[model samples]
Each structure stands twice: as C-alpha cells, then as structure tokens.
Target: MALTTGQHSWWRPLAGTALVLMATAVMTVMLASGTEIAGELANRPLDSEGTATWGDIGDTALALLSIAFAIPAVLLAAHCVQHRPMGTVSSVESRLRWRWLAICLALALPLVLFTVAVQALMPAPAGKSGDLAWAGTPAFLTGLATVWLLVPFQAAAEEYAFRGWLLQAVGAWCRSPWMAITPQALLFATAHGWGTVWGFTDLVVFGVVTGWLTIRTGGLEAAIALHILNNLVSMSIATAFAGAFASDDTAADMDWAAVAIDVPMVLLYATAVLWVTRRRERANGTDVPGGPNTSPPPPTPQTAAASRPTGYMDPAAEA
Candidate 1:
C-alpha cells in the first residue's frame, strides 16, 4: 500500500534506513569475518574466488541472517514515526495476507524449477565439481537446513526494505509509482556489487520485475515469494553442481549467452505471478488492479486492536 500523508516527513524512513544499514553492516562483518577454516575445507589462497568450504557456508548463513532483521525494523519504524499499523506500508488490506503469500509461493514453484533446470543445462567447466555426492552427506544436509531456514528470511528482508519501506516512502514523496520503483531498484542492483554486463543486467531485470510486482500486488507477498524461491533454487543448484561453499565472485570470463535467455524469462515469470495474483483477486471479486478499487478498505476493530496499521492513514490522522 501507499505511504500515507505526512509519511513524507523524511524522519521515519531515514532513521529506519540508517539503523538497518548500520546494524546489518556491523553484524554481517562480525559473522563473516572471523571464522577459521578447518582441515575439512578445500583450502585456497585467501584472495582466490572458488567453490565454498565449510566455513564459507557458515559465513553465508550468518550473513543472510543479518539481512533478515529488516522486517522488524520496518514495524518499529512505522510505529515510531507515524504511530500507524504496518498496513500503512503494506497492501490495501493493511496487513500481510498470509493466504496470498502461500498462494504466490505455490505459483512460484514452477518458475523455480524452470530456473534450476535452465541452470542445469548450462555447461560447467572442468575442475568445478562440488562433490555431487555431497548432496547425500550429512555436511551437505546441515548446509541444506541452514539455507532452507535462513535464506527465506534474507530474501524477505530485502523485499521489505526495498519494496516495502523504501518503495512506499518514495511513492509518498514523489506521489508517483515510477519514482517508487526506479531508484529503489537501482539501489538494489548497486548493493549486489559489480559483475559482467549480463550479470548486472540480470539483477536490474530482477529488480524491475519485483518492484512492479510490489506495485501490482499491493503487498510484498508476490515479490517476497519470487525472491525466496529464486534464492532457494540458486543455492540448491550451486550446492548440487558447484561447491556449496564457493565465493560470491567470479574471476575468469565465461560465455553468458545462456544467461541472456533468462532476462526475457524473468519478465515472463513476473507476468505469470501477477496474472495469478489478479486472478485470485478477481475470484474474490476485488479486481482492484484494473479498476478504481485502490481505495483502502475500512479498518475494523480487529485491526485497531492489532497494533498495526492496515490502511494508508496515519495514526495521527485518526487521532
């Protein structure tokens, strides 16, 4: 949902953003920087970018956990700034619709499978095998558990930050959806660091699609669903084919023609998710996307008692 009037104050968003950045920075560095590699790891020079080791997996999980706190930051920010419920920055319903999130996740399954299948078809160079047998090992299972549990929180935290907090704040300031999506998407891509042209393009494409999905779905459900499943698929494939403990960077040049095909596929995937979202809304008789039902629903007693805002009204407005 849109940020309400007076959300443009610049105080809340700025404060929340500062706190999130500082906290995530300090925590992630502490989590990732200190772990000593054991004899079980495939030792490499400290500077070489290669497959992951046991220590790498631990660092990655911890880093993802660091990013996951944005969800709490958002709620606290909303309350402290506007004294409004979370719905003020969420969808028209004024809160996260758990049913919609579940349905979107179901819709995302095929997309995730397709992505993994495509990556599988891409050729992997020699000397890059990540002990495919490790998939059956206890160590791999432990990594799998960590990824399955923490990765979703990592993805959700990003969506809530870019698509939830920053998106609505920008929307409220500029009073236009374009402003909301463009800068936030740019920030998202930039945060991931530089890569090859195709790789950078891929992030941009993903950023735009998820931004548009946030606008279309009026909540983080569709966006979060897409993010969570995509990361899960990426992690699983890396574990199965490449080393699960690999570094996040690449050094040598590789052909990206296969990745090029995925750009259009991302747009198609986003469209499919949105189509499902609108379809669900239509079945419920809302059809808000194409119609003028953008007006938020009236807040009920449940919402009032819930200590979260579900509508685009400032708590002070009601006061």
Candidate 2:
C-alpha cells in the first residue's frame, strides 16, 4: 500500500505498525528455525581442530534476522523522505551546534564514570569477574562484529518507527505536541519489555528526553545521533568491563548505586540540550511549533470568508 502524507488519518500509522509487527514475526520465525538448524549442524564433525559453537551460530543468525526486521522501517523512512522533510531534519547542523554536542558528551561522561566507579565499590560476586576473554577468540570476534552491525540497525529501526515517523504522524492527527509525544514515549518503553525491568525503566526515561529533543529540534537527526552515541558508549563500556572482569563462573555484577548517580547526570545533560537548542531557535527567529513563541496570526479576509458561507451557494458547493 502507498504511504500517507502527514497525520490526516489514523490509517497510516496503524498500517505502518502492522507492517513492522508482521516483519518482526517473520524474522522471529526465521531466526528460530535457523537456530535449530544451526544446532543440528554444529554437532557434525569438522576437519578443523575446533567445532563451531551453537551459541556463535545462533548469534550470527539473530544478527542477520535483525536486519530483516528493519525492512519496514527503512521503507517508511524512505516514504517520509519523498513526501516532505520533517522540520527537525532541516535544522540538524544548525541546531546541533558544536557547543551543545560538547555539553551532551561532557554531561554523559560524568554519569558513565560514576556508574563505573559505583560498580567498583560493590562487592565482587564469587567467581564473577567482568572480563571478555572469549571476545579475543577468532570465532567470538567474528560473531561480535556481526552483532555490532546488526544491533545498531535494530536500534535505528525502532527509533525511526516510533520516534521519527510515529511522532510526526500522531502530531498531525492530534494537532497538539503533547499528544504526539506522550503515546510514542509510552510505546517506546513498552517495546523494551524483553529487557530487564530496570533497563525498561531507563528506556522510558530516555524516551522522554529523546522525544523532547525531536520535538524541540524539529528533526529526528539530533535524537538519532544522540541515541546512537549513547548506545555505542554504553555497549563499549559494558563490553570492556565484561572483558576485564570476566570470571570462570560468573558475570560482573552491576553497581546499582552508580546508577543512582548516573540518572541525575543524564537529566542535567538533557537540560543543557534544551538550553542550547532554545537559544538557537530564538536567535534564528524560527517558529517553534507549540512553543511559547507560537501565536495565531490575525485572520485574513479569505480565511474569514472560508469560514462563513455566502447566501447563494454553500462554500463547499463553490469549491
């Protein structure tokens, strides 16, 4: 089906969501079946010294499947690109001033460092060392590369589907900024149900910040860039710690106390982002939709006529 323009109706968003869910289901089945096949194949003898691990094969299959899951989102983004650019996309380079980027990174750095420090303070679990010795192995490295590529694609797809397209679509319908952001944030959080409960909570909070960024900036690129950077940093830190602290029997235990410190740091970073962006908008005289600067212009004569019908024929009949 052809994609719709703007938020004229609910059908487009519903259709897009249906497409995403169907694609997800198809990818899930493919991965499950491929995993079973890989498991059977792994049992066979090989000429090489080491046999393939089912875990490695499964990871590879899942990575490939993730790309498949992103197909619908990619199509939807293409559709948006063709129809009209979201105001946010147009403002990317201008709004994402170097100063703001630096502030965001600076803010994020302290939170991440504090998180790591708190983990250090926590008592080490018996047999738990967060090390990635396995990562150095040839097989594992190959699998890791595959996962790295696919994981970002998955994250991008989800953000595009929800934050990018859905936000625009809903805003068009409700004609209110809050209506657009609220449900999308809820949906974004709900989508993370498979993650740890705390992880889901973190995503919801992150979603709010990211959604606001999209709204404030008038484009998805800023939010997308930030989201990607955040994930890349998070994964890198986690992997490094996991490799360094790997134990014979257990994974490294997370320091929850550090998380307590990190949360406030993220809020501070978000505040900085808002300040930088709002300043830019004001300087440029750009109309920030739904913001305080937004005011209805005086009605033109044509607008007044359009509202009121003439005696001879209905305005609708004239059209």
Worst 10 residues of 2 by lDDT: 307-316
The residue-by-residue lDDT of candidate 1 on 8-95, one tens digit each, is 4656666766766766666566545543343225453343444333455666775678788777776666666655665656665667
The residue-by-residue lDDT of candidate 2 on 111-180, one tens digit each, is 5566556656766545545343445555445544555666556556666666665665565455345666
Best by lDDT: 1
Measure candidate 1: CA RMSD.
6.8
Task: Give the alpha-carbon lDDT of every model.
Answer: 0.65, 0.50
Going through the candidates in the order shown, the clash numbers are 11, 15
Best by TM-score: 1
Superposed model 2: Cα runs more than 4 Å off: 1-7, 27-68, 71-74, 77-144, 194-199, 238-259, 282-319
